[model samples]
Target: MASKSVTLAEQSPQPPKRLKGKKGAKTEARTTQIGLFTVEEPEPFKKATPAVHISAKNKALTLVQHKIYNALLANAIEQDRDHAGTNVGLSQFSIALTDLVDKVGLNSNNRDYLKGVINSLIGTVVNWDFLEAERGEVWAATGLLSTAEMDRSTLTYEFSAKIRDFLVHPQMYATIDMRIVRAFKRAAALVLWENSVRYEGIGQSAVIAIEKLRQLFLGQEGAKTIYPEYKEFKRNVLTPAVREANEVSDHTIEVLEVRQGRAVVGVRFTVARKQEAPRLESVDSDLLMSVTQLGIPSSEARKTLGRHSESDVRNALDYVRAREAKKGATPITNVPAYFRKALAEKWMAPEKSSGTKKAAAAPGLSITGITEEEIREKYRASQLGDARAYFDELSAADQAELIVRYNAWQPMQKWRLESGKKQSAAAQQSFLSWLAHETWGEPSTEDLFKFVIKGLASTATA
Candidate 1:
């Protein structure tokens, strides 16, 4: 399921196909026979997404939120096709909360947590063509969502006008079935899945640099610095992601590591719908979903599911659940991690010492070369989106301190920083630049160009 990305396109944003109604709900399309389990209006993006910024402690989307978002996008696309050319199903549509929860395998018990993820979309800002400074005049940005709220047992939402158009009339896009999205245990696997499917027709993707792959998974914010050594990155993120992508998604992918005299420099992915030897699903999807609800990713879930017998996994889950349900026991702060530890240690085995088990608790707190000329592009857009993203990752207090400094430094532009100034895009952008530079010296164009190519290579599909 390769999705769309914002880069230098051969064309500009397409005009709205439908008449600009005075007002409507958020986005477009999805499909379902019964409104009960039906996806409302889904618009799937292969997860080759825009540069995004969210105002939150954890700036990135959680695994569940990732699942939830793709669900909405999937429905938006199908709904519009069902009611084509008529103003039948406009934006701000609603989906059955039961349907959403059941389809995406979210926990209904954690109501506030679920709602928290859904509501967070409102504050999410998405930017397209921001890196295409070469096409400066065509740069565009918009909120990923305009409004997101729940009414009774149903969730209702709308996409920003710009996003709605992108979802509905995307010049290039791909569908990532919520079913497959559910199977991904890591966000990187989801990202990789999206990248692979886009070139499914061509049977392979363009050779992408290791740095660009990092950006695809981690985004530009500090992504360049995280995995300096390819082996470490491959061990932690790549190996598991590839395994999960192969096992869960229909696509079978092979990694062709590009070696520069024995130092792995980059890799090309060859993808196709797999011709699998029949093997048992082994663990039921429903059971895996329950694991996901507790914070285990689908890839992890799949691995755990495969290593142990279904009964063993079930007994382990029960062990964790009973511990959580213990009358006077301190709550397990991390249900998922603890559960994994349980499976690894075989906590459910009858011969294990009860005393050792009671005394033992889960241990916690266990904690890049760029290709040349890949970054030799002109006009890097100063990577304002990248800067803004890094800025948002700061603590609220830190963000405020920067704003105060900016206000004082540029008094003429101070009004723009004043509270509730709508005409402040310019000011906010400038402040972020100042803050980023003061915080981390300006990034080199070589590095910025590496960031730009995350999406650039995605465009070279058949």
Candidate 2:
């Protein structure tokens, strides 16, 4: 038996999508120009069609896994676009594990499950060009990921060569909005959304066999075992997927049922891009850093940001930090919950034991005979020394992991990531300095003054 192959003439032509915005449209895709290519913003990440149609032998991704993969793809494409003039291709890509969980509605503090997801991708076989008619003679079968590992707080991964090439340059792909992906609770809805969005540029989708659609959303075995009857599959899975696609996706999809004398055989989607494009969401970098520092995921933080003003968010953070740091202050077991309450209710600054908030101490003989700034600089230096010593003591593997993280922090003309990559001595030294400073953290009023107060005590004794 021979599989049907699609000839060039057999496929319908799809012109490039128009980028021109209509009058009164709120937003278009936010993009960054990188040499010849314009990299789209991460929210509406471009997903390769063939990769999305990975063989049903591979189990359908869990909801978290689905989000993780989308986020990783977004980052990969960004790196690809950014590395335009550079010699390095995508040999091994790295992303802050925190960023992964932060954007995908996962708890950044709980990473035990992420390790499992990475392992599964590395183990799953990717039967590329599985549908022979899709690509005609171009096919390769390999693990979905060539190599993947969690190096402390960073995820370092590589796609198998052929897959990597196609992924980075998908001839035809769908741009998926991450905000929408975050809204999906079920993997089925996500998979359906992916399948539907590819047809977004065109007004409607071509007919798809019912069995293929089922297996695409729920692995082969699941399609067979879970929904034994067609009506049950339609009622439980297809209907909800369509409803979710309409609610959260960029399009409103109406499924056209294909039937033979009332027995359904296939379906096609009539999709229309939403009238108003989703605005590019923005969050203040300073406030984002503050929120994530308190064990809140970035996604959750963004929701809070939507509800409050920047000034309010900053004040709430200040109150939380002050209340937590005061002597004999009650320990907050749940930082995120506490911060949310503080922000929503507009918590006022906590006072010291004297009933009034402590005033900033100016340069004076009574206050350690040193200026506040001077004491802060000395304290920072001490922290830097401590961080340098701690870094030096780490095992070679651990230090290397930190370097990988530094390299991932792109927009620098330093490291070259090639096969058998090596870091330049200068680059290594630069990373050491950065790590020390990062460990030291930016000086803040409460934190810096707290150190100054302690330093004053030691100075008085001297």
Candidate 3:
């Protein structure tokens, strides 16, 4: 037999769709049989894989606590030092307090009053500094002033004198309520450590304490003014008795009701009768259709669908299995061959068509300015949802171009996503929107717009 070559028409290219404005005609509405997978609820709290034990809960809360602690500490230090045009070394401030107490005479009434003032002022400074130090060594080392910039004389005299003045000034110290401020600082740092211990592990708790203490002195605190490391330790580290007392307090959950933007969704829980943990319940039919229209992942759709019932989807799977067993008709398990062919043809057809024919198919839409590489990059940055949205927005030619680019770029996007170099689906949209506004002249491509959107889609994805 002569050597024969064969082509698969089912795998071959087909024509792309062009955008068509609706004519003034009406047609009967159609109904779709959404797959049962659409009805299945996804467990939001469920572990990503079968092997995992715990849900990724309390992570966002712990992170917020850590960030808030660091921010408050830095703010406290800035308030104290920024007015002086340079940081008053914590060491110099401590020496000034010690000197003030001694000068005021320990046994005298003046000494007692001065001691109170000195203690309160030092307490404020130490509490704030301790907080910054505990957050991380990076903050402590670089917080107040540069290590290379330190001069002993400038710190001892000029810096110490300002702190002394602030300490003795009764009116100013009273106005700031230095003690209450320091207490807040302590609360912030301890909250983070406590949260880490409670949710993460005891090992993390112990490590946090040690790291915080270490960071406060040699790292963030030491970097400021070479203050006696004792000051940071005194404020941060718990004595054996204090540690024992802290353990008693730790068992009780402290729910700080902060106004987080997205997490709260119109549910309230009281101490007496806690509400069941909220998950997606029964989705309205319209919402389900919209979700299907968007082509949401089956897992996500199932999760949303599951939210409707008292029994969680995981718990209900056995019942579902039983129900299916009783039913004679089986579920739809395969995409129709024709539908699959149509899907394949939608993307593959571009390869067979000339570039001019592809562009000419959609009138008044510009593909002349867009490069293949640019389209590939944007498509790579885009999520499946984003690609869908982009598809919906494009004219026939633009959609054709997208089909061509996505077909080419899917492999590259898959690799980047798998490697953890790229952000999630939601982040990609925000980044692209921001990059479009900042780098490009406009938000979206408009037919008669003056400026072409400079392609920053790669940088957005990055």
Candidate 4:
């Protein structure tokens, strides 16, 4: 035994190889399944105000209301798909209350809080109007979760058939990340996010009329009484929502105000996908994809975007895209140079003033020997002339009605200013609409505002 040393092969046994499956046997492969979520009838649903519960009270949907409604829609769609052979528009389904709570991330322990949310969902009404075959059709429906009953820990619910059809077989829909929705703390932010997703691939900023934006935020009701002043609305609603969306959502949105004279009449939101951490292998490839999206040459976009963060580069691309989308935005003659400048300078928003300093310097007192006050006088005269021209365009009836409405609104304006209260955009629109209908027989709100501005300018000059 001492003379014969053990060989290494005799001391150890090799582990058995993983048994290969029989030929033709099913084998698992590494795969990633991306979940696709459906939105209820795409366009109308995206644009339709989820302002339930407060339409009667002139209020919009609260954050909780929005969350619950979306949760129901998502859950219904998922359940219908999960059960094999189930009808696509099946109205009835059962979900655990706990599951609903968890999905919505509701933290309250009180059962009634949940009950209140459910009741509100049952009472919420959503209206859809869309174009089909070049013809406009309207569908009015109430109660997102129209029917429901809770037994012990489980809840049974039914969605209206109209809603079910829209959700199950959506003709127009946007794929959304539910995680992003869950992260939004404000309803306006969520609405904006969804709208952005809906219009993601269009290569243009989504233009929402100021009035429509109001409705989207406050529902029909809340839009009426809240944030009467544009400044107040911007401070309280638009700015905050946009900031939150930029911080938390998958897209970066920048707002552009479309103005008539000094008043903001509409807004354009430029949306672009936020760039993720660069993949070592695909950085250049990803850059090329962005170039394609931006409608720029691959070599150019890379040179421009390479120096900036992915987000900064995408934002610059979006800014250019938005300009291209505008009706008369000046075309860029030099694409590479423009991209370089835009990305380098981070031109997210349009310039507020152009060549003002140059114009002011052009009229220098040293050259003309004219005082600054004289320059101011000349500008005032020009403005006054423009105002008079606009005023001359108004019908006599409109002129007369303006005096009346201005007088009527004066007291209200004074009261609001004195009390430190704000007039909401809705109230302003209502006043303008009423004045226009009374005087001009149903002119547009924009026209009415123009008339009012001209009239007020004339009065100040007089």
Candidate 5:
């Protein structure tokens, strides 16, 4: 009998088409179509405690771990509507390991490294707290990924049902560039980025009490006694984080100290987008060389040049040099100070007339006997004495809270001193005004200052 002939269709079926890697290893199915979904923006307004708990506490996530967690959340949110219920945890999705590696901007050669990150993420346990009807509530859960498995070259994970609402259905969220998140090496900077991004359009300035900031960055179980010295804290934590954000991210941040008398109470940060790149001019090596010759440090000169236009620096340098050339002119005792003042004030030419000897000097600096340094020191001492008196008048808890605020503010003051800048009176008054409002309802600015320093002598005593 003739055997039935078998066709190719009746034999083995072909595998789905997949992109190939360098080694010809099969990757996930390639899709040329653009993805039409919005990354579920994280709700920045939600108390940062939960995010901090997940990101910083319980074995802080490595860069890869952070990226993977984010990637899962983004993918889950994109597929949320397609799944049933408000729970992203109920929705399961699979991402090709190769696709994920590419999306996170990682090298595909190190599959083992990616596996380790996945394992760590699966093993992490997060603890968080919530308020239920004015009562404290505690909740503990596993990492963001509830279940994860690897099949072939695909990574499959489900979002934690406990955090589903917080992750996807946020009341208010921040739309951050994942590219920026991937670029951050330090966890502190990423935390700060999230904190600041939420307040982006609300106002140019954002203020966070020191205690809250600590909780946000260090987590609930982190050391309370750490960063005891404000200077150490600034050097180790604040400056580096702020610098990274400003350098790589779209936002420009200026940290300001909020003082209550002589002690720093908090920080006020002004965030703004970087100005558009200005029209370029031919490099003025001559001006830079002149700035160095005029006793400005080369590093400082370079920074000044970068900040101001060459024409501006050149004009300022010319004015200063011309003044020095005058026969009777007092040689500029502080060349760096002069250059800084010139650049700051945009001084192009000498004043037409020396109406008064005092007028000839820079606005803040003095000509005859006193220096700006002396004036600032005197003002600082007075402010401190006033703050101390006000601090003493508060109740125990209030005083303790004020001390925490002071701890936060001290670093900022030290930063200003190290940078050769003085804290302005207006900034101090703003802090005092905020304090007064917090302490005893709202009061007029004059009333606030008067109450804080009432019955105290004006004399500054160490």
Candidate 6:
């Protein structure tokens, strides 16, 4: 296709954007009519700036991570104040914050996330003044805390309490995302630790104890709602002090939140303390043995021994040993001391013993065979009610009769009565009145009869 030679004009295609500036550079610059030399320009400058590089989802995740680390650090600071009597230093705070962030933020085996968090924190903190100024309006608009009163201790308390209230309530902080709740928790911890330690001069141990106890409460079996700082005082402060003083490790520091006459929230501390090891003197072991036969809990038996001096234990043991030694030929059983005393009294007085035996054997709920003291125990739990209410509702004669029947002559006489015997109408009314009086006017005769009869009949049938 060799075409006829013709003076034909050729046009060049425009260079692509990537090559535009460089491509024209190879051409020589021609002088224009104005005699000024023109040259090609370099690419536009893109000024570098600091910003988080992440998608929206990752940004949210990063904020949550920061909150958790911040919370742990604040809690640690609060604990230090409680135990050591001073606020944590900045370096200590930084180390703790970094440690927690490393533990929870990075891949379980890496420190990359931790380093990033630390670096970001340094940068954020370094420009905090400027950021606060610029963000002041935005934060105030957020209605989390008032910037105007931020420095006041009362403001801290009010805000912290508000956040806590939010966490506890379903309408306030609940509408926010779970991540926000976590962030608020961390922020609240920081505010609380600062307010209490710096302004109130509360100790660190108290705060730590409280936080640890709070965690334990969250793990309780039936707990519905847990306050983040609920147990801080009990666990961090009270338990440690008490544990130190008691020389025992089994005691607990408890916080109870009561509402409408019922416990709504409770926090308990399972604390360890340095106790003086139990030193068993020769007598202590014997006393323990004697109490054991009586069915005292081992802990209580140990406590009884621990309370007494070594000399007293020896004396008590000597008395027990000698008594046992004298009765060796009879081979006395390992009965309780009180039981032994009763047996001795019966053995010593044959006539009185026979009378006691007759009364106990003839019992229709009578304390005759048992001691007079035993008779009193039968009615104590069954008949007693609110004293004031009972007296208010009972007639003077009835009150007198009740007191006489229960307490007259040390041991009142018990009349044998059958439960199934039907009473006349008048007698039934009287019985109902007596039952109402006994129940502090809470139960009418019909109600009492129905409940008691139904229960008894059901149990007997069962």
Give lDDT for model 4. Answer: 0.51
lDDT of 4 by residue, 7-37 (tens): 1011112223323434212122212221110
How well does candidate 3 match the true structure in TM-score terms?
0.19
Give candidate 6 regions above 4 Å deviation. 1-105, 108-115, 125-458
When summed lDDT is taken over every stretch of 10 residues in candidate 5, the lowest stretch is 1-10
Better by TM-score, candidate 5 or 4? 4
Model 5 stretches with alpha carbons more than 4 Å out: 1-55, 82-89, 127-142, 204-206, 224-226, 275-462
Who is ahead in lDDT, 4 or 6? 4
lDDT of 6 by residue, 19-39 (tens): 233223322321122111011
Cα displacement (angstroms), candidate 6, residue 414, comes to 49
Candidate 1 regions exceeding 4 Å error are 1-60, 87-89, 126-141, 222-225, 276-462
List, residue by residue over 1-462, the lDDT tens digit for candidate 3: 211111101111121322222421111111121111111111111111110101111111122222222232223233333234345434232223232222212222233333333232222222222332334622211111111111322112112332233232221110111111122222223333233222211111222233343333233333333223433333433222133223422222222222348432221111100111222223343443333233232223333455434223222332323433555856523222212222322322333334424222223334677754555445434434443453343222222222222222333333211111334554444433432222222212231221223334535677
| Model 1 agreement with the true structure over 235-331: per-residue lDDT tens digits | 7667777888998776787788998998887888866545422122344756766675665533445556676887778767777777887789887
Arranged by TM-score with the best first, the candidates are 2, 4, 1, 5, 3, 6
RMSD vs true structure, all candidates: 25.9, 20.1, 28.5, 27.6, 24.9, 34.5
User: Across residues 41-97, which tens digit of lDDT does each residue of candidate 5 receive?
Assistant: 211112233443342343334445666676666555544433535443445777777
Lowest lDDT sum, 10 consecutive residues, model 3, at 46-55
Position 112, candidate 4: lDDT = 57
Task: Score candidate 2 by TM-score against the native.
Answer: 0.50
lDDT agreement with native, every candidate: 0.54, 0.61, 0.27, 0.51, 0.51, 0.29
Kindly report which residue pairs in candidate 4 clash with one another. 58-221, 58-222, 227-424, 228-423, 228-424, 229-423
Q: Lowest lDDT 10-mer window, candidate 6?
A: 44-53
Error of 2 at 204 (Å): 1.3
